[model samples]
Target: MIEKIEDIKRIELSQFKFPVNVYLIDDLLIDTGFPRTAKKLLSYLKNKKINKIVNTHGHMDHTGGNSLLQGYFRCRIYHYPAKRSYTVVEKLLFGNLKNFTSETPPEKINTDNYSFEILYTPGHSDDHITLFEKKKRYIFSGDLVLHGEAREVSRDVKIYRAIESLKKLRTLRPEKIFPGHGEIFYGYEVLDEKIGYLEDLGERILRLYEGGKSVKEIVKIVFGGERFPYFFIKGYFSCENLVRSYIKDPKSL
Candidate 1:
């Protein structure tokens, strides 16, 4: 349930697909696990002295347990300070997501002894933010930097914005990445790798678009051949959504 990464602790339920990656470093709590793992998360938080809850983004899984945690700890919460809205496709696939809000945090999040800089990194979602610790070169990146290539995170994600966010993160030259889904990355060129992934995907999108392929056709040509969860649907969780995102922000090309 809880694992050690130096002084920070990672709490995950490990029950279903892509569980939330919540981290506790000193007095800061970055992202909360889903509702299914709330009990375990509460157990871990009960013994700790957390003063602030900083959410990397407003995704449901990352913020599901916020009310419960806030009810228990009654600490200040931080996020990208944006209103929430759902796309027609997302509503059809996963209905009724809650809106989350938090005051824009100050430049420096000064805890008892440690501090971090809050960065607004939008792409996967509009309200995404990444926390960077300057002294240690550590970044708490939410879904902004997942393990692999970015695609169809939601129908609303912006491919260009994601690329821009990655570029901004790469500027920080972080030594380690604490992501939202997978294990922690240590001493690796994590940001550059993600940037390269998006660059390559953008190239593929442009090549397909130049060939006069529709978004649906592009999806099929790019990722439709891979079989796993049937991806025939047009709007909901299909590569077509990714194609549309790339089309909107083709500057990445």
Candidate 2:
């Protein structure tokens, strides 16, 4: 599905129940959804001009099509450097990130009329970023702000950083958030919802810790324990990760 929000073209490249969106503005593409969906994305943009590609981060779901799309268009690919290497499971599931040539994306990218400011807002991942169109008050939040509460974070996620990033964006007061997953959200309701949930969750976690609840017990009580597919990821993505982050940095909120 393709929807136009003023000058931006949002392409739902992933057919998953929870989709990943790739935004296109003029010759620049915000993200490339997945490796398997590259052909589909390519066919969709066969005639469209693509001279540059900017990935919000190095995650496979976001950068999977990088090699193919860049090979095809010979466009320069820009992204923030990955803070860490991909996990074994990540490599198995979505392949490794390669062909990203630029570590520093321009602070601002300009099209014929619109301008987007690249904001380094990590937490979801150390390299995660959001694209902000200041005049329009629109934020292309790349996994920095999801639709619901952030209960279980992946192993690499820094809960403290995530909270700080949320606080930063909250100050921006975005009117609309084009998230990496889920539908576009209007106003600050969803953003505030996530921030509130995470903050409350952290306090609850701290209290539980003070009560002498072990991380395992805390996970069970707070998040029902890591379940199903989370276990399949070899604890790389789990509730324990979230608990650990806060336990390690209680003063960071």
lDDT of 2 at 203: 93
Tens-place lDDT digits, model 2, residues 173-235: 899998887689899777778888888998999999999999999999998877745455747
Error of 1 at 91 (Å): 8.0
Candidate 1 lDDT over residue span 73-172, tens digit each:
7777786673455455444443344443456777889766567998888888778888899898888888888876655556658878888988898888
Q: What value does the lDDT take at residue 108 in candidate 2?
A: 89
User: Top model by TM-score, which number?
Assistant: 2
Regions more than 4 Å wrong, model 1 = 82-101, 225-236, 249-253
Q: Lowest lDDT 10-mer window, candidate 2?
A: 228-237
In TM-score terms, candidate 2 sits at: 0.92
For all predicted structures, in order, the TM-scores are 0.87, 0.92
